[model samples]
Target: MALVKIIGCGNPLAGDDGVGLKVIEELKRWGLPPGVRLISAGLPGLTILDLMRGADQVIIVDAVEAGQKPGTVIHCKETDLARVTFRSLSLHNIGIAEALSLGRLVEPEAFPRRLDIVGVQIAEITWGKADLSPLVAAALPLAVHTVYNILKGGGPYA
Candidate 1:
């Protein structure tokens, strides 16, 4: 049975903000561990409830313009995320962080044991399509490694 689900959410046309999707594509090449499911979402919040209806763990990869240095990676848990004081250029209407918290409230039992966001800080968010910045692009491997380590319960930060 699938025990974990990794959802990459972003808009590919929005410059470095699309890092999540890019990572998803790159992840395909590495393949995934057994019991782990990978999916790409274009800001579908509630809709994901079904896809992750009974997952034991969930990891969300998204681009966040949190005013930090570009390419900086911020890993935060679900509860900690609720304390965030600022917003980014999210593709969803209610915001992914709020959606996940509300999702957990609606189905506590079905909620993942671990819910983390692998956020990559972006320097620019443009309207038109463009490749990811070198900095953000360089972060994909580290982001993937971070997620893997988080899944294994032994990340450097963990």
Candidate 2:
């Protein structure tokens, strides 16, 4: 099992909501430590529970309707994730947050040792295969850096 897992969850067809997928694409170039794994959900929301099982730590990236600037990025730990207020990822029937919560209640021992969420503020969530908006696109680098730092056990949010 990997020491760390990074899962990008979002829908490519939903405009800026695809930022997580975009981050995953770039991260593939950077590679990871021997005990690290990277996976893209492409809207595999609740499935996150299974992906994170047995992992020491998990970092999830997704686009969220935080009502901030288009490119704004927000960091949240497991505790924060529980208190988060988002209806759901438009592409997902049930979201990661709900799934994680359910997993904790149903089989706490199967949960990851650590869980974190890095949400990027979405501008356009309209239905289409359009690329991310320029604002959200601009935040990609920072988001990448944040993820790197988090995985390495060194970051502002870590």
Candidate 3:
């Protein structure tokens, strides 16, 4: 099993919502350690379950609507995920909370030992707005660093 798996979820065509995938791209530039897998889960809201299998730890990075400023990065646990919803990656996909509930019922044993969410607060997720807003773009480094810290030595949030 992979020691840590990082799944970056988002729609690149949807402006700031793309920060998740962008962070994966940045991580790609740096050499990743063995047993650490990075997945660009673009719009894979429900399918995330499959990507999560076989990892000891799973870190999901995505856009979140938490009534906060656009660039804020929030590290969320299971309880926190229940209160915050990821910016809709698709019209048909269910929320992260529902997805986790399903996972618990259908395949709880397959879940990772540790699950964390690194969410970037977004103002909006317009389908055709291909560019991230200035604030969100500026926050990309911070988000990436957060993921790196967790992967390297269990970040403060951990």
User: Number of the top candidate by lDDT?
Assistant: 2
TM-score, candidate number 2:
0.90
- Tell me each candidate's RMSD, in Å, in order: 2.2, 2.1, 2.4
Tens digits of per-residue lDDT, candidate 1, 1-158, equal 64888888778888887888887888888888898888898667577666667778888888886777788877877776645532445566767767776777888887777777788888787778668888888888988888878777753331
lDDT of 2 by residue, 42-127 (tens): 77756778888779888989998866778888777867764655434666777777777887899899877778788888888867
Instruction: Look at candidate 1 and tell me the lDDT of residue 98.
Output: 70
lDDT of each: 0.76, 0.80, 0.78
Positional deviation of residue 42's Cα in model 1 after best superposition, in angstroms: 1.5
TM-score of each: 0.88, 0.90, 0.87
Model 3, C-alpha of 156: deviation from truth (Å): 6.0
Which parts of model 2 are misplaced by more than 4 Å? 82-88, 155-158
For model 3, state the Cα shift of residue 32 in Å: 2.0
lDDT of 1: 0.76
For residues 1-158, write the lDDT of model 3, one tens digit per residue. Answer: 46789998888898887888888988899768888889998877568899888889988888777777888888766656645554333432775656766886899999988888888888777779888888888888898888877776654442
Model 1's number of clashes is 0
Off by over 4 Å in 3: 83-92, 153-158
Worst 10 residues of 3 by lDDT: 83-92
Give the deviation of candidate 3 from the true structure as CA RMSD.
2.4
